[model samples]
Target chain A: MRPVFLIVLALISQASLADSPPLERQQALLELLHQDCGSCHGMTLQGGLGPALLPSALEGKSALMLTATILQGRPGTAMPPWSSLLTQQEAEWLVTQLKQPAPPQDANRH
Target chain B: MRNQNLNNFRYFLVCLMATVFLVSLPRAPLADVRGTGDLGLVVERTSGSLTAINSTTRRAVGKITGLGDLSHASLVYSPDERYAFVFGRDGALTKVDVLENKIVKRVEQAHNSVGGAISQDGRLIATSNYDPGGVRVFSADTLEKVADIKAEYGDGQLAKVVGLVDAPGQKFVFSLFEAGEIWTADLHDPKNPKIQKFKAGKEPYDALISPEGRYYIAGLFGEDGLALLDLWNSDAGIRKIVPEYAKNDPKLPVFKMPHLEGRALVGDYWFLPAVGHHEMLVIDRREWKVVRRIPLDGQPVFVIPRPDERQIWVNFALPDNDKLQVIDTRDLSVVQRLTPGKAVLHMEFTPKGQEVWVSARDDDQVLVYDTETFREMARIPAEKPSGIFFTARAHRLGL
Candidate 1:
């Protein structure tokens, strides 16, 4: 009975890990946030045609709401839906990253 | 005999010392003494640097660094093509001497700037600002503020300026994105400009002046048509053309805005990139009517014409940004489709249009191709490149 319970626990953990993107994919998504999304929103997310995505600007916004916006996009604006490219989990991950304080200047590789 | 040998040794020493002195002196000044006609600049967007390239040698001669926030940077050259007035997104106006490969003067002109233009006579430089929305003109040589024209609208509200271009008669034309108006500043007198305003359509996102500097056309983002103003006939006011081109079609999502520039006009037909659609709209310039719609691989970003106007090279927005297509002007058909690289940002033709240089930002390389044979000629290393401006633009109107 103990062996069977341990197998079930391991399976559940594996399923959860599979839901999240891999390490390499997370890096790629961060790059996309900086470059592709940066084209409209400033590279540092300070705002251009689009609004700033900095932590200060997004302080009141919920992570889930931001994720939904990323997935469905704002209609009638220049912001287009990124659902075709990003999954729900990935979009949520990006939102969390945006909500955090920007890294140090030297940390930006590019 | 010993005295004669000693004299010869002294002569040899003198020659060796002279050769060393000549070689040790700075060679940069001598090498930089060249005409600016063959020079160009590549905006390394990510690095906040400009790679000064030589079209004749097809090599990057020098890299000018320290210009801040070059993500959406653009520049116009002096009439002599020696100085490049770079407009940064951070509202920094930097005048760079391309020959000297350094910044002559830099001023944080505004909180944010979209682009800029130099006057027809090349004496004044005008920058279109996004933040604290207004147009500021400066002395091209001194970078000193000459005039300030705020884009004030209803109840003192400011509107961001876009698509600023230089016109023929020492004039500057630009569109107010939020206010839906077009303003022309006649800077015949550097300090005082005669400002003319016209009511345009819903949202004028970008604009371009005609090659002959006769007409100013602004593309509307809020509506289906474009606003055209005839500089030759100021009394005619602004006319909306192709009002029903996309009225019946469902609007698709636009990842990037289509750039409206001077090269869209090819002879009688004006080839323009339709917003939110994977198509190129070919309009009859004489009647200002949509004549044909050529389907494309993706939403066209830039519809650039080759120097001779025989072919038009196009790059698309995201999801199809890696692909580049060329259209035959005569047939109005897609002639060639090539996958140059990731995020193909901008393209520029040689002075005579024999070869074209394309910047692929994500790949960190600029690919040069032969226009006639459709062959890859060369590849230049760059850091997230965007705009490729050649000195030949100095002589052309509305570049």
Candidate 2:
């Protein structure tokens, strides 16, 4: 029983290590950001009441440069600092995802 | 040279740390491009502006604003079809010229105004508010607050008082709201009016009085049935819940909750939806019981009865597959299902009964449908337009 327990624990740790977001999961996250965040911001990430979060929105800012803006946040503006809610790693991942161009329109677009 | 080398090494360390930080930080901010253009126009309840739809077709028509602090506004067109009275959401009242599309006058906030009502004679424009537990009477012509009659009720009770129907003779105004109670106030003297309260339901929202003014039926949102009220009986228990129809139907989306805000008196029967039961509660006025529960497609919100009382117009409010479910009350069967909008809220029939005006809140526009054919007639752009009433009789009543 002790030997089996040790094996199960090892397997669990390995599984968790491989739990990085897949393409579909990343797309879903992007969709939520677009839907929920786009309400206040322009759909294309053009400036509205909120500062744009897209590549065109940020004018091709580097990942590190964007991280500084998100971590410190714009004071006296609606853009709240995300450092509290997001980890450094998660912010880095988000910045990497935003760097990609939006997909072309499809026939089944909702 | 050794000290200079040491300084260069320190600078190299700093650069490495910065590079690590850049590589580790998230490269993207969330891209929320989805929810921006869902609803065309949003009526800012806190702000007093009627937002126009961002479309060329809508912009070509026009935009009107400057009605003050209008909260949860219910609208009604004048009898002569010249003007519209907006029962502003915040209890302020405003009148608008329908053709010119401009606000004529603005009235200040009254009690907790939820529903807007015009008297039969159109001489009195009365609206009910929930918080202060009173109704404000306004002169339709002058847009003046003529009177405020606070009804007597138990202390520490918060009654919403949503539904108001002025009796045919215009002698009394009957209304029901949050606490499931019915009220009758004498309107002969608008100022210092006499008010009476009756235990109507466990929770009531919208009500319809019989044309003859002998009986009143209210949709109880809390109790999930219709509450019958006897107008003439002073000591008689006027409140009776329809037993057979009160239970929620498991089949429909509006199943078994209790009540929603739609009721209409058609022919000798009152057709309404149970809040939880996706079925329409058909009350046989003659029998005073829920004789039948007509099952429907989704959570029914508004019921538009034809002037001829032959057809019943019902709209489901679900965001997905939201459509206008038309029930021919004559047979209690769904004759047609038309997708009016994404989500429908309230509707009113033109006095001529030729056209039906439905407020598609999800789409931020009012859809007009021909009564006879149920075909799309025209669309009126509105801001979160929900409540509707008519003005033809209103002009005659001087309201």
Tell the DockQ for candidate 1.
0.33
**Model 2 deviation from the true structure expressed as Cα RMSD, one decimal place:** 23.1
Model 2 lDDT tens row, B141-234: 8778877766545675645565676665565545545456777777777776667777876656456665566666666544545676676764
Q: Mind giving the per-residue lDDT tens digits that candidate 1 earns over B101-194?
A: 9998999999878899999999999999988798999999899999999999999999989989999889999999899999999999988999
Clashes of each: 0, 48
Candidate 1: where is the Cα deviation over 4 Å? A1-20, A103-108, B1-31, B245-251
The candidate 1 chain B region of ten consecutive residues with least summed lDDT is: B244-253
Best by DockQ: 1
For candidate 1, the TM-score is: 0.89
Residues A2-63, model 2: lDDT tens digits: 98777656643443344435545455445434432333243334322245566576655777
Q: Candidates' DockQ values?
A: 0.33, 0.01
Worst 10 residues of 2 chain B by lDDT: B33-42
lDDT of 2 at B301: 58
Off by over 4 Å in 2: A1-110, B1-63, B68-72, B77-81, B156-158, B172-180, B232-237, B247-263, B319-321, B352-354, B371-374, B379-383, B388-390, B393-399
